[model samples]
Target chain A: MSEKVLMKGNEALAEAAIAAGCKHFFGYPITPQNELTAHMSKRLPKIGGTYLQAESEVAAINMVLGASAAGVRAMTSSSSPGISLKSEGLSYLAGSDLPAVIVNVQRAGPGLGGIQPSQADYWQATRAAGHGDFKLLVFAPSTVQEMVDLTGDAFALGDKYRMPAIMLSDGILGQMMEPVVMPKDSIARIPERPWAACGHGDKREHNVINSLYIEPPVLEAVIKARFEKYRLIEEKEQRCEEYLTDDADIVIVAYGASARISRSAVNAARKEGIKAGLIRPITLWPFPTKAIISRIGNAKTFLCVEMSMGQMVDDVRLIVNGKRDVRFFGRTGGMVPTPAEVLGELKKIKGGI
Target chain B: MLTIVCGHYGSGKTNFAINYALDKAKEGKRVMLADMDIVNPYFTSSEYSGILISNGVKIISPTFATTNVDVPSLPASFHSIFETNDEVVIDAGGDDVGATALGRFSKKVKEKGYEMLYVTNMYRPFTSNADDSVEMLRSIERTCGLKATAVVNNSHLKGLTNASTIIDSLEYAKDVARSAGLPLLFSVVPRSLIDQLPKDEYFYQADVYVGTIWEKGED
Candidate 1:
């Protein structure tokens, strides 16, 4: 067994990236995610990895683009507003089909949000991480250990599909400290892709990496092929955790920090004789539709809990498709709902019946 | 096993609190890792709550303690610590300013007669010498109205760290304890370096919790 070490969420994510063989890091210093940047800055040079604290989120993401194009494991991190600035580069990365990792330690926002934890970027991460007809595999880690585990996996998955893996962690997950066990052997096995923008060196035809195609038919084909890859990812990469749902009547659906809070609520509600269970989506993008749909038969009602204004609940509502009554409870503007508050929500849901 | 862990910022108080709680819980003790860190919003015990719950440890914090607000949200529930008989581990916020919140419960806490542990990393700024370390403890004790019964040696420079830093801090830990007339409870050493150090010393084999990424990879 690997000895477990205590680590903050952001630090764990950075360490896991290094473990995954990521050798280049480019990021701007932002609240909540500073630990990750600081950690990389302190350690990357010693390990012969490149760490650059870019001038802006724009420069940082573009730096990742340049490194990833050369077929190197690279990443960039920022918060909500910073992510907004990196959107153009994010779209570019997707267009070029370059593999890398992007971390968004989400804070409250529509415009410069507070420096505390918030999951308000759910829609932005899942629906439109970048402006284009593309999808990034979004992983929502609820614990520090998950942050470490999924971060390593993020690189491998990004490499597998030749696209970026978006880790949507909020401030709560970014700042908290916990005992974490790094994987025994987690160096990502990156296969050399022929499409990589590396030196041809007089061997075969020159390979090009670009997202744009001026020819209408060529662009349509490129977009169609990207969708095909996304389709496969959705089918194979969906992950979630189900707790005490075997005999549940009312099920609570949540993700990330909200899921951890809801876990406490579920345990408390069960003691109160309320058959409440929880469904925590590990992968937010490929939305665990089948998982929730399977539980709809045993559950009479579903309560969607989030730290945002009912963003993920919309995805749940779509999966339920009017089969069962779906109720929503959310707290926005950087306010995290306590476990007692979540339990109270469950109690209210119980009373409505 | 109710221990109040207090220290200056970057002193590794939160890390020590987590390791101690997990150790007690693994020993079959029902642990309560309470988060009284109402001041610093960046790092706190509330984040490890999920893993702690899995280990059968209960966590008690303010309604929105980890939420994005500067408001001191601690409620009257601070008195609930006296109600639990489990191994209660209190993770106080950094410095005297943060430890002042503990004063509200000091009366009941004193009546219960618990041990207050002052954690120190001699390598951190302003805490490298004995006088500075003792002064930090005195201020925290005055603010919380509680005397520290022991000191934990948690000194390291992270990536540049090795067994020598921890060994060197043992003398610093003893000096602070000697000045405060307290016991040198235990020195924290990374588990990997444990074999190289003398086992005769009072030590807790610590995980490399506060180190950088290059310092990671040991299982």
Candidate 2:
């Protein structure tokens, strides 16, 4: 039987990681995300797992790389600047095809922006996290429950594809306390990893995990093979949460905290006699572009609401392909656009004035 | 003059405080800059340690003693420096922890007759509206047990920042300051966009004019 428990997104993530058999966690503390490190610090030791508050984000991510190379489930987390430091390590992980989980409890930034929640990292997470010809599986969780469930999925996908999986979260999600139903024990047995480096003796060949491919052609082949795996991920793992879309004239596209606020906007719009709906992307990297395109022919307009200045709007425009008028409503630097504010934007788009 | 710069993350608080410390040092004042941000790894005032030190600004940071910079303990000397220095600037961590830490030093600061500025970037989270800004200020006050002396309206969107966005942000910040019973200290604008803004905007509100100094010199 599933039981409901009150949890923060960070705690949910830690629990989910443990449930997924993740045994190593290396991170630096940052506000709106300290709870994650705190939770792991307490829980990991109990389960005989490893948790280390690395000296810096650079050190933390490199530690994750070490743990991953050693064939174990490993994870790391930070905010914007810390995430920025981890980007280089992420690129290395992707190049080497090593599986690991990286959580960015995104805060406002181009620099040390703020500690308040911001979905500004949509571009950073969905695009290459660093300078490279590679991609990471980026997942966006809207609810605390999804934070728990998707983290498990991230580990499985990371191991299956032999690449990095990132949980793109924000301060609001990390700090907000909510009720979530923890997964049953029976549901946790799937996706066992045998490829992990727990040490193989003379029974097998030595495995050296490195991103260095000196020859250009061989590197090109490795990249091509990684792309093939990404294609499979895209095909099999495009996740989205659609709300009140049937018979709606307008659709609001958002993810994470913005999605929660957008839900309220949809409800507010419906009360005002506007048929507005919401489509929330669960996976940001394997963006549900096809799902959006499929509905574009029917919806009259689409509104992209985010905490950043039109980052995800670009993706909406790409999917709509001029099929419908696309509008944008956003708040940046950790400011949450209220439900009423989003409803106001919907009213403008729906000609309800 | 003791100045404590407080703001949310990415609000340019560190940049402003660092420059202010540098400006004071240029005037030959014995300036001590204490970085209380154990949160952000990049772009803190202490990140420019070399330049600040070379320019005769004393720098105190989490990395000052500990190899583990993420969760560094504040030194006991941090409190005494405020009493000794002619002008000391405290750059607190972002949000809750920063506010809480700054609050702990409030009595010492009050004793020293220091000025605390609550920096607000109108484009930032929880500060976009007057109500939200007021709420954040109240929370900060609750955490620190001291009210902010002034409000700094330093608003901008990273990369896509423009003059109009700054104006819109300032408009909201003006309302926030008025409601919170604090004077508007200044509005921070990028050096490139500064030319586009009307002089009147700064004439009425700003006590100081500033620019981004992160890329200015060798750190």
Candidate 3:
């Protein structure tokens, strides 16, 4: 049996990256997510891995892009404002179709928001992480154990799809501590990238990793292929957790820190003779549209709970397509809505209060 | 009996504190695990609230330690730990800033006649050598105004830790303990590596009972 270890979310993610066979880490220090960089600095060196604290988040992300092109599992992590700086690098990574892990331990945003946990970056991560006609495989982890498991999964999925994967976490998940049963003596085996830019030598012809095409039609063709890949991801990658939605009349849709609190609220509502259930989106990009569509049968109304001002609520409304009324309850600017607050929203939706 | 654990950051003070409290509770001692960390918001013993409550070990930490609030405020309820007759374990924050918070309770801790243990992961930045370790210990002592009663070897490679890592850190830890004139109480070993450890070495098995703030349920 694997022994459980009490580890903080950031430290666990750093270790998870190491366990996933990541040999290179490049990141800049930022609040709420700085522990991750510190942990990587300590652990990466012991394993003969490279841990470079880049001058800026931009420089760090570009370094990850370079490492990925060189055919190595590399990663970079930061909080909200830092992630925004990495946006251009992300677009390039997507355009170049390189696989690397990018972790965003989210904090309140809009511009140097407080260093508290918030899910305001939901749109930024899922809708358009970087400016381009591209999509990323975003994994949202609600628990510290999930932070470990999802991070490893992000690497796997990134390598499988040959694109950047965002491990979307909040300050809460990034800094909180949890008991995680690590896979004992587990070694990650990511297949060798034949197209890596490592010197071709005499083995084969030189491989190129570039996103630039001056010609309009060539760029269009390349973009078409990328969308085809995204279509497959949308079909196979939608992940979520549904709790008691089977016989629920009201369903709460939330993710990340909000979902954990929503679970508590669901349980509280159930004890009050109200049939409240929760649907937590594990992968925000693929969005879990099918899960919401399937739950419309028993659920008459849906409440979207977020730590942001109705960011994910749009997705819930879009997925439901007005079949049922979608209401939103949020606490933005680093304010975390408690179970009691969520339960009050649930009662309001059900007209029981 | 009161046992307080203090150390620098990345030194595994939280881990040693949790395990020691659990051990005392398992032995039928009324245990209270109090988190004296008001400095570092990211890591603290307060995250183990559920596990402590489940194991019948009481906890006293800042009410908003797990929240996003950066307020360096400690609640009045914290002083109750000193008033209780139960065995209390204080998990002090790392460095002088963290130790300063522990300094506030040192008078009460002294009045109660408690034991303070300074944990060290020699692999940490400043404490990589015995001299530096002793120096950091003195800094902690100066901040807390109470001397550490013992030294615990908790050295590891953060997450890439293995049996060899533990074995390698033992000598360095012993050196630190010797220089500081403290007993090398016990080296903390991950449970999985216990059987693989050298039988001659003294050690304590630590089952990780804490997780990050996001981990919210009882283990």
- Please write out the lDDT profile of model 1 over residues A1-353, one tens digit for every residue: 11445566888899889888887999998777877898799789998999998889999999999899888999999999999999999999999998889999999988876877789999999998778798888999988889999998889888888988899999888876655677643456767877767887878887787877999999999899889989888889899999988899999999988888888888888889999999999999888888999998999899998888899989999999999999988888877787778889889989988
The residue pairs that clash in candidate 1, if any, are A2-B219, A3-B219
User: Model-by-model lDDT, in order?
Assistant: 0.83, 0.78, 0.86
Answer with 1 or 3, whichever has the higher lDDT: 3
Candidate 3 chain A lowest-lDDT run of ten: A177-186
Q: CAPRI band of model 3?
A: incorrect
Best by TM-score: 3
lDDT of 3 by residue, B51-102 (tens): 7789989888876786756576788988888788899888888776678988
- DockQ of candidate model 3: 0.14
Model 2 ranges off by over 4 Å? A184-187, A190-198, B1-219
Q: What is the C-alpha RMSD of each candidate to the true structure, in Å?
A: 11.2, 15.6, 8.1
| Real contacts retained, model 2 | 0.00
Off by over 4 Å in 1: A184-186, B1-40, B43-219
Instruction: Give residue A97's error in model 1 in angstroms.
Output: 1.1
Candidates arranged by lDDT, highest first: 3, 1, 2
Model 3 lDDT per residue over A1-353, tens place: 11455566888888888889997999998878878898899788988999999988899999999999999999999999999999999999999999999999999878887787889998899887888799998999998789989988999999999999999999888866555656433669889899999987679888899989999999999999999999999999999999999999999999988898888888888988899999999999889999999998879999999999899889889889989988899999987888888888888877842
Question: What residue pairs are clashing in model 2?
Answer: A71-A197, A112-B10, A113-B9, A113-B10, A114-B9, A114-B10, A115-B9, A333-B125, A334-B125, A335-B125
The TM-scores, one per candidate, come to 0.70, 0.63, 0.74
Per-prediction tally of clashes? 2, 10, 7
